[model samples]
Target: MLQLEQFEVRERKLQFIKEYDVEKIHQAKLIVDTDISSSVSLIELAHMVGLNDFKLKKGFKEIYGTTVYNYLYELRMQEAKKRLLNSSQPYYLMI
Candidate 1:
């Protein structure tokens, strides 16, 4: 009976996480885009957005079709390319 009760509790928690996954994923994307240059870990991101690490990682990929790191990396690279093409500033200074 105790084991069954624990299982039920776990399931409830997971259900709650799933219910909020969409909102959490949106928040995660905003956090990443807001600071693409900064190094943020999954735990940090999940904490900031009120999600567990596993749910955040899985939901982000499900909603965005890419991992969080990859999404941020692509954004950074695109921004760098745009700056390099648009600005006459030296490459070293940009770095």
Candidate 2:
């Protein structure tokens, strides 16, 4: 019974978050993942998603389990690793 009550509390907390907030967070992630070369500022991205910077940061971290800056860094590193492994030419020759 105690566990069920705690689960209900968590569910209520999630319900308190507006649907738009979830949509905006998804938009931010899509933009970041699909356009890796984009140099848009965090404020600009937040505005594009119709959110303020603070809410954007909070919602993004809550949903993705990491900050936006860290997410971008990880994606970039993965991309670099992929290219290095899949490059047609030898790594030494490219240097």
- Which predicted model would earn the best lDDT? 2
Which ranges of candidate 2 are over 4 A from the true structure?
1-13, 90-95
TM-score result, candidate 1: 0.75
User: Which candidate should be chosen as best, given TM-score against the real structure?
Assistant: 2
Candidate 2, residues 1-95, lDDT tens digits: the string is 99788767666665767888989989999999998878888999999899999988988876676888899989988988898899998878865
- lDDT of every model, 2 decimals: 0.84, 0.85
Candidate 1 residue-wise lDDT, 1-95, digit = tens: 99788767666555555667779889989988888888989999999999889989887776666899899989999998999999999999987
TM-score of 2: 0.78
- Model 1: residues >4 Å from true position, as ranges? 1-17
Candidate 1 overall Cα lDDT vs. reference? 0.84
Root-mean-square deviation of every model: 10.5, 4.3
lDDT of 2: 0.85
